[model samples]
Target: MTANPRGPNAVDRHVGSRIRLRRQLLNLSQEKLGEELGVTFQQVQKYERGTNRVGAGRLWNLARVLDVPVSFFYDGVNEGAGQPGFSEGDQTPIVDDFIQSADGVALAQAFARIKDSKVRRRILELVRTLAAEEAEATATEAAS
Candidate 1:
């Protein structure tokens, strides 16, 4: 089993993305995370980009520091990917995408700070309504 020299493996990328997501969710900067890991910011960037593969011990350390289990990084990995009969699917990780974006993060932070449960439910309903309307508008535009 040989890895491609062009880029990181799928599993490595997934693990790195999970690390990045957790770090972002905690509002920790790359430098802060690097400091905790005793590594430079650039090294942390590399790790998050999957340019460097994380070793088992380092991954465990990351899990400890991030307050997640080591298995968090491997949460969505296909059981038999890179095998003869199994192929990796092209599904976008929507939660990771949302977590990685500034607007999404800001929205989440603001929503979390709204301490009232009724207000939170109302906000959720509003967002759902807006999304449904937007989707309908897009479909109508496409049909025109």
Candidate 2:
């Protein structure tokens, strides 16, 4: 396939996002990850943004440093017939973006620690309600 003139292709972007997610999950900074990989932090940023394509060897090193298999980078990628990006039905990109954030990670960690299923369900309902209310308020304000 021809290189995308606009930038890295979908697969690269997906891989970069996964790299970022794994790094964040381990509470590792881009600088720290870069140090481990013997690259500059800016290079790490490029990798995470998909501005740079990672080679096979580099990807293997990343997997080792991140404590995940190389396949983890392609976990959410869709390989439908000729399609080379995320599947239409997948909400992984959005969810991944959220989970990569500090608040999202914090909330997820805290929620996961709750052993009571009922309490967890209640918390989920509460969050859903709050989100619904916020959406409604935003819609109302937009219509005004």
Q: Rate the local accuracy (lDDT) of all candidates.
A: 0.84, 0.85
Q: Could you give candidate 2's per-residue lDDT for residues 1-144 as a string of tens digits?
A: 864555677678778888998888888999999999999999999998888999999999999999999999988776651255533445455777688677888788899999999999999999999999999999999999
Give the Cα-based TM-score of candidate 1 against the true structure. 0.75
Cα lDDT of model 1 by residue, 47-125, tens digit: 8888888889999999999999999998877676435455556665677678767688889889889999999999999
The candidate scoring highest on lDDT is 2
Taking every candidate in turn, the Cα RMSD to the unseen true structure, in Å, is 3.2, 3.3
* Collision pairs in model 1: none
Over all chains combined, what TM-score does candidate 2 have? 0.84
Model 2, C-alpha of 88: deviation from truth (Å) = 8.0
